[model samples]
Target chain A: MDLYSKEVMKHFRKPQNVGKIKNADGIGKVGNLRCGDIMYLYIKVAKDKKGKEIINDIKFETYGCTVAIANTSLLTTMVKGKTIEEAMKIKKDDLVKKFGGVPFIKIHCSLLAVDALAEAIYDYFKKIGRPISKELEERHEAAEKIGEELKKHHGGLFKVEEELHKEYEK
Target chain B: MQKRIYPHTTTRTENQRYFNRERRFLFGVGVYLDYAATTPVDPRVLKRMMPYFSKKFGNTMSLHSFGQEAKADLEESREEVANFIGAKLEEIIFTGSATESNNLALKGIALARRSSSGGGRHIVISQIEHPCIMESAKWLESQGFEITRMAVDKFGRINPEDINKAIKKETILVSIIHASNEIGTIQPIVEIGKICKEKGVYFHTDSSQSLGKIPIDVNLMNIDLLTASSHKMYGPKGAGLLYIRKGTKIEPILHGGGQESGLRSSTVNVAAILGFAEACRISKKEIKKEAERLQKLRDKLIRGILTRVPNSHLNGHPKMRLPNNANFWFEFIEGESIIIQLDLLGVAGSTGSACSSIKLEPSHVLLAIGLKHEQAHGSLRLSLGKWTTEKEINYVLKVLPGIIKNLRKISPFKA
Candidate 1:
């Protein structure tokens, strides 16, 4: 069976935000070569009305299959110009629903995209010396642990997708 | 290959221009470069096979004129297949697939030796054998047989000395593949076969990938048993052959209906056997001319990709590999992503990346060749077939650069 959906292909064919921001405020990197995927997300933060920190621009560099690249592309389009809280509220399921649906096996690609964004936020908060939420901190802790696990075992049987899948979604 | 030029020296032009180009299906007949996986059955072979389904649909085991007619046809096909490999008519035993034949060759000899030989329960095989051979050896290991997996050089060539050193008083069998299915590196079977013959050990070679592409002679190469597949050579899928030398010590693995002289037992597939025989006939006739023609195209494809696309290295032996195969691993980019983007431009190829396999691991053959995990993930295999045209190869050379460039831009690893 084909692993790509028409909606997914549309985004993969032309990822909207496909470059890095020069002098970006925050950068998040996730996934690894062993997983056959790696993602680096860059975000530019600016203060808006109500003194809120909003994402002015977001872009990503991804080395993965069609679904993973498309997930990051759709995510950049969805969260642009939104407050940090609003971007964090956008779950992987919402992004997956936007694509009609992805193959169940490839659902982890969306999870990587979502976690990459969250990690970017975590980086931004740490950079500004602001306190991170307990929930986001816990998520980062699990994500970081898996990243360590990926280092020790080079080619795992189940791979990081199933492990990350069991740990948490975005 | 004697002079390894570190391929990191490359120049990147403005890749932004390619992203704006029109994305349309550019070719009418999509370029099929995955011939190593399987080939479309030859129309002539199919034509010959059509009548067997209904008109000549008689069981070879039946006791009637219809049965005798089929039985005669079956023997004729077997004779043709045997002659193609330079074997006696009775030496060829048809099975369902190459995997089955491999299972039979490994287990049959191991089990036979276990029961007959005095406490000899050891076997030796190369590390780069197909999954069937590897798994069969693993199964035997679990059943109290000691197996030694011989390693290869960087070019995936096995040394005969390793085979000689691996042999022992208890070593009963040695199995190796004639050519690799993944990287297409041909082995020194004649040397290894001679080594086995000198030691009085049984030598079996899996020729599934090399039967039609190259020459094979069982007696001349000192091969005691060999395996060949049909679907890999433009024939039907359900037919494969195992050529066992007349005096080889072996026993049957499949005991049913006592077919194929009691070695392999099942109702014969008349149509597929006929098609296999015909395919082998055509391959024997055109092997020389087809190999030369393909070598020219293969060289062109390899040179064009290496010089045109920077940071790419050939996987197998530069000259000793198959004439129809060209494997490469580009720096910084993964293989499946490159395949997907190439498929978008109307080219079908395969890769060793984990994303493309059900087992979710990069090719073990690549790992055995001592490539880094990241390097192995970035491999692509483009194998040619009978219908592969010069124009199709040029199209691949034209489209592959942009795909690699785009994927590299997305990748974190830099060249």
Candidate 2:
């Protein structure tokens, strides 16, 4: 059975923002080989007219199924031109709603896209030394623990918290 | 191997040149390459089945003329299937499905023999029997029986010597699959059968995947029991058969109104059985020429994908595989992703790996062949059928290379 909506298929057929952005401000690399899904989400942050930091550009490279890739593609469109706090407000439910619906089995795909975006935002905060909210910090910590565990399977391809940080610094 | 950093140069093959994000993917008519899962019923079989459903439907054991007619046709159908497999009319027992047939074969013998004084309490099966057999063996173990799961080589082919060594004085039965459902590796059942015969153990091969595809002579091959499915061979779904060689001591798993010599005791679905018989009839007539046709097409697909796409490898016994099956796995990508992209382009295929399963595990069959978890996850099974045309194959060849290239781009792993 088709696990994605017509809208999801539309984006997945021609997923926008699929390539990597070099020297990006914040990059979120999440997922593991065990689940056979991973995403490299790149974001270029800029200030809008209100002098608030906004997602000027976003793109993703995801190793996943229909919903995972489609949601990642749709996610780029959802957060572009939105302020960091506003983009962070976007949740997995919002992505699912925007794409019509992702099956219950594939809810994790949308969750992964949400996690990738959140991780990118956290990375941006860390890169610029901005004060982070306690909730965001907790979620990031939890994601790191899961990512760290998943990393044991394939440490090379699945870049986790510390390794991803090291890569960005280099 | 070190992971290549981002912005690493990827040598684009000729196929990748066709990947234009701007040019819309040409959605062709749905091309089915997953015939192993199930086949649409043949029209001839359906026509033969129609009368049995409404007109000649009756319980085989009833005293009335309606019952007599159904009973006559049932035996005729049984004889036809029995003749196809070179087994006697009395040896064939009809069941609901292949799963049921396999369960009956494993558990029936285990139960019937456990009570006898000299009957052995050990069963030997291959490492890669269908889940039905595996679960039955596990259940038998819980009932205080010993099970020997013999291993297969890298190509998923079992060595007869290993089976010969694994059998014990207490071994009563040995079950192995004729051909693998996932990788299409055909086992050497004839030699295994001889070894079992020499050792005084019954040999049962699950021929659900190979029954109509390959010729079987149970007597010549020394097979004591065999299982065959209908839906897999362009017949109805509700019928399956177990060939219990005459004089084999096996008890019925399902006890109801005494049917089929009281082996499988249920009012038989007359229509499905007739349809299955007709399917066997047609398959017997066309098996030789069709096998040749499918073999050529299968090889074309295998060669096309391996050459067109880089970092792709074939699965299963490359030389000893089934005529219609071609299984492959590409590096640095998941099978579900490939299936979705193929589905969008109007092609149907299956993956050995099931990421969405509750356990989140790849196919055990692929893992048994010594593939890594990620390698197993990337495996795809493309099986051809009578309806598969050259045009459909050409369409797949045109699209598959690009699909692999596209998914590999997003895949984090490097070749």
Candidate 1 docking band: acceptable
lDDT of each: 0.84, 0.84
At residue B46, give the lDDT of candidate 2: 93
- Where is model 2 chain B poorest over a 10-residue stretch in terms of lDDT? B18-27
Residue ranges of candidate 1 with Cα displaced over 4 Å: A32-34, A145-170, B1-28
Across A38-134, the per-residue lDDT of candidate 1 in tens digits comes to: 7778999998988999999998988677787889999999999999999999888998899999877677788889999999999899999999999
Question: Over the full model, what C-alpha lDDT does candidate 2 score relative to the true structure?
Answer: 0.84
State the iRMSD of every prediction, in order shown.
7.1, 4.2
- For model 1, residues B1-415, the per-residue Cα lDDT tens digits are 1111113423232222221121112224688888899987876688889999999999999999898899999999999999998999999999999999999999999988898839599999988999999999999999999999999888889999989999999999999999999899999999999999999999999999998998899989999999999999999999999999998878899999998998888999999999999999888887887788788889999999999888899998998998898999987677887888888887888898876766667888988887767677789999987777687889999999888888877654441
